[model samples]
Target: MFTIVLISCFALYFINDKEYQQTAWIVLIGTVFTWTLISYWIRLQESELYNRINLRVVNYIKIYILLIGFVIAFYTFLPFSVETKNIVAAIVLGFPILGIPVNLLVVNTIDHLRSSNSNTKYTLVAGVGDMAGTVEKHLLRHNGSHVKLKGFIKCKKEECIVGEDRVVGDLDHINDYLRNNPVDEIVIAIPVKVSKKIQSIITAADYHGVRVKYIPDYRGLFGENYKVTRYGELDAINVRQLPLDETYAFFLKNTFDKVFSAFALLALSPLIVVLAILIKLDSPGPVFYCPIRIGKGGRPFKVFKFRSMRENDASTGGTKSTQKDDPRITKLGRILRKYSLDELPQFMNVLLGDMSVVGPRPHRSFLNQKLQESVDKYMIRHYFKPGITGWAQVNGWRGPTETDEQRKQRTMHDLWYMEKWSLWLDIRIIYKTIFSRKTHKSAY
Candidate 1:
């Protein structure tokens, strides 16, 4: 539709200008390709845009602005008369102003008809708790929701909070029921305390490619920003999960990490080479230290770092923390550690996909085990890929964890970071790491 509209506008503008026939074709093709790419990037085909009028309007405005910019930029380089450019701009701008509403109306009407009772989705509820009952009531009472409750899958008959007649089957029969019965969506309204059972149900739903929604029992327990994800009007939350769990968020973070790491390595090649040579000359050991550190999901990966200590430093065993004026440090190592230059090699780890450029720093296996014994949520930090620098490090939580309280505090910061992660937040951390005064204070 966009292609047809754009090409029509282009033809209308350049039909009389036979000398600019090639330019019209170029503009038409470029506009269509650009809009197509932008649509995919913003997920315009997703139902949410069509269902939410305000979102649809906002996206249209954004796309219109982009189109205007692209047209002006394209014309700036082309040998076009000022009159021709003005005509093209006027024609292109009309495409969004007039076409967007028509497109929205068509999509909205189709969606409305599709969401009728005759076309309702057969939804299955897992668990018989108050949340499950609430969900069932909501689906039944809301006519526009277009959801039909098939039945509930209870954990046990005695434990069933809802009526026995409503209980279709137990967890043991969920797979069989899903196979025999036609279920479009599965709503898991279980408590966070029974996460193991919830996980199993979710796994089954995923295996069958069925839509799964989770309603967390513990809402206020989480940070406000990390509490709920809204699908249209239905709100759900995945307990102890980060936004990165979503496909788009994961893609954004991973893409940024790869691009930034690659660029940093390229731009800093000269410095990295100088540092590597200096480290090799200062220490008897290898220039780079590849230590196994626990990364995302408790997976162990070798983290790269320029060697900043003696060949066989006792601290390498994770028995002791590096301190001020440590004798294990080489003369060149002191400077490298002060400005975090020793961590420069970790760009390689970032490029290798073992770590991120910004996240909770990874801990050695021995230290991880020791910290896990004392700190209740120490291991939660491993839920995200480890980084060369982290929120904790920038906020004065870096250096040696001399006390259990220190480790606990650092873990708290790490969890908070994961809960509130964004592209801007990562950029903020990177900026602070380079400019903040406190960043190097605890370095040894």
Candidate 2:
């Protein structure tokens, strides 16, 4: 809707050739706003992840529209030259897009902290809906999150939580419980079910004279993804399904994986050869370690890395990740692994379509098996090919996860990267990797 409105506005506002030519960039911005709104609307139809992004994008559209309007008016009234126009265009174009969400995310977090006590409160998940689970996860922001414990309220007898949170009671008398107990808000969470049952629940909330708000459920929707929408001005939400699989995101990541991996392999061939020779002399193993790793969709393939362990190192087992003083490390291997040079040859894996340049690092068979059992959404990382270096690795998750918390944090970062994956982000990560490097004291 914003898209067509933008086009009509541009067409009507800038009719003459000279005027249109002068205002082309500003009007072109309207095209972006159009697409922004449309894409959000589209993603709203599919993935729950995109819905949040769509909201951010829509908010940006508002800001962009206002800025564009001001600039256009400035150009028209001030009679600025084309050079001035170009400067304005560049400045307008350079509005920090990715940073906007990051900023809002920070601001929202700070605001939340200011308004609410830092004390951890026990949250009651209501209605067994998407919003509830989302709220539950959001409430569990960090291991040290403010909301201390979590409980649930079941709307149906069949609905139950598998996690540690205890079910408190039914929502029918939820208001009384809230009044008596120090319970937080009774968040009305409904899944993607547009039925009379949902309508009746909304009516009940209204008749009760209590404040009720719902977040849409995104899981298990028929379409590719899920989105949250206001539910008929009542304290309910509509879960709209959308095309979930992001073809563009997948394509962009894959392209980078292939292109950069191939380039690194070809360009660094001499360095790899030197490393191989060093490995042969220093260690009693093959020049390279070809460990079988699980890739996208549970496909198994040998991942190439400059050999970073002794020949007798266990290839298959449920072993904790190596630390700074791992005995398994050979003399040369220690140096190689320290600078992440041992991971260099995984460029071959990337070229083979077994991995990506930027993604969740692939786990060994033993670890994957262990984690799939432990982490709730562990295997979702396999939705895309594992990366030679990933969001986890660069962001200080380079070494083994000895603690459950470390593993969970690593997995969460990987998932966030997947949820908000973008080509530009990948490039930024790659840039950071090359410059910042994942050099940590913990990395053995």
Tens digits of lDDT, candidate 2, 1-444: 333344445554656666545566555565456546644654532332221445656656665666677667767887757765664555555554443555457545754574366444545556665456667766554323445444666675434443434666665666565556664344556555532345555555455544445654445453333445556785432333312255665676667677777788789999988888888888686887776778889888888877777643365353556656778788887888767888897887777777788878887788899899988889878877787667777788767777798799899988888766777778888876766755344468
* Candidate RMSDs in order: 10.1, 13.7
TM-score of 2: 0.51
Candidate 1 local lDDT, 265-331, one digit each (tens): 9999999988888878877888887777899999998888888889543445655667889888899
- Candidate with top TM-score is 1
Estimated TM-score for each candidate? 0.54, 0.51
User: Candidate 1 — which pairs collide?
Assistant: none
User: What ranges in model 1 sit over 4 Å off?
Assistant: 1-218, 221-237, 313-317
Lowest summed lDDT across 10 adjacent residues in model 1 is found at 219-228
